[model samples]
Target: MAEDLNIHDADPVEEFLPVYGMVLADPALYHLAVSVGETLDRGDRWAGAIRRQLTHAVAAHLLGTYTRLKPAPETVRGGLAPWQLRRAQDRIRADLAQAIDLRAVSESCGLSVSHFARAFRQSTGIAPHSWLTGERIARAKVMMRRKDRTLADIALACGFADQSHFTRAFAKNQGTTPGRWRRLMEPEARHATMP
Candidate 1:
């Protein structure tokens, strides 16, 4: 004599009992659930299909987690602020090997020179010039590792003006000369790579 319940109200606890039980045992089903959520959000049929596949993957992940197996570590939280900084940082990073103007960096962020320097230092915990120097040195290290590049070339490419200037700056910032760093990175690359 009772009215029938709709699909959404069909005693989900009872209906999902089999699924929950299976997922609990499998420890991987949670990933499948997360993927399904993502797929639904993408607003594309193909995404939905991909989500269906990921639903299975999520299930497997959940199964592993529930079982106390080696579930993947949680991803670090990233947010919009870092993304905004990344856009500006990309420009700075690209021009590190050149004569970087602090004013330009500030202008890029729509701030005046002094205001930009202060904000940048506050956010990055280093002065803009220091940050730029570090970036240049990091790039030089990458170039030095290639072995095809000479210390002089690296110095020039990294905007040190001359080999002596590069050596002094590298030593000041990196605690070693460019040549020494390259040797430490690749002992075999010594003669063949040096200019």
Candidate 2:
């Protein structure tokens, strides 16, 4: 069966079932199968429900195996789907003032935390936390343009814990403290407003 499916030793499948070819190729379906397997292994109270889901997934996999030999061009191989990426970005941007919950974001995209993190990094060329930090810094820069907003306000708004935490992160990324950056931007802001 494995030889027919072209699956090798390195493939993620443990049992080498014929239907696994289609299921493993599809990330969402693969995740569901793995989750169901784990739940069954743990002997969940809802074992019957989980087993029914597993049956359905296996049936779908088998149907797909016979029906679709060619892989979809848009199918996720290593990275997130466009819609998943957009959803994650939107979720992250929706509440920059609050601490980012990676698990929540991953769940929102119907992915496990580890898989989502890997796919996200593969797609964006950076880890999710790094991306979030970059976004916070970008937002802080924009907020700094306004003289009325204090550094503490910018920090909190950008999801930093406090002024000191924000200062450390800002300096690490920008090579200057938040206060200095603000001071540096003051001239630019003044020059722009003057004309």
Winning model by TM-score = 2
lDDT of 2 by residue, 126-161 (tens): 688877886788788778868888899889989999
RMSD of each: 18.1, 21.5
For each candidate in the order shown, give its overall lDDT on alpha carbons.
0.58, 0.71
- Looking at model 1, residue 152 earns an lDDT score of 88
- The TM-score, computed over Cα atoms with residue i paired to residue i, of candidate 1 is 0.51
Candidate 2 wrongly placed segments (more than 4 Å): 1-77, 188-195
List TM-scores for all candidates, in order: 0.51, 0.55
Residue-by-residue lDDT tens digits, candidate 1, 49-96: 797667555544444333212222222232113444455577778766
Mark the 10 consecutive residues where model 1 has the least summed lDDT.
1-10
Clashes of 1: 18
Q: Backbone clashes in each candidate structure, one number apiece? A: 18, 0
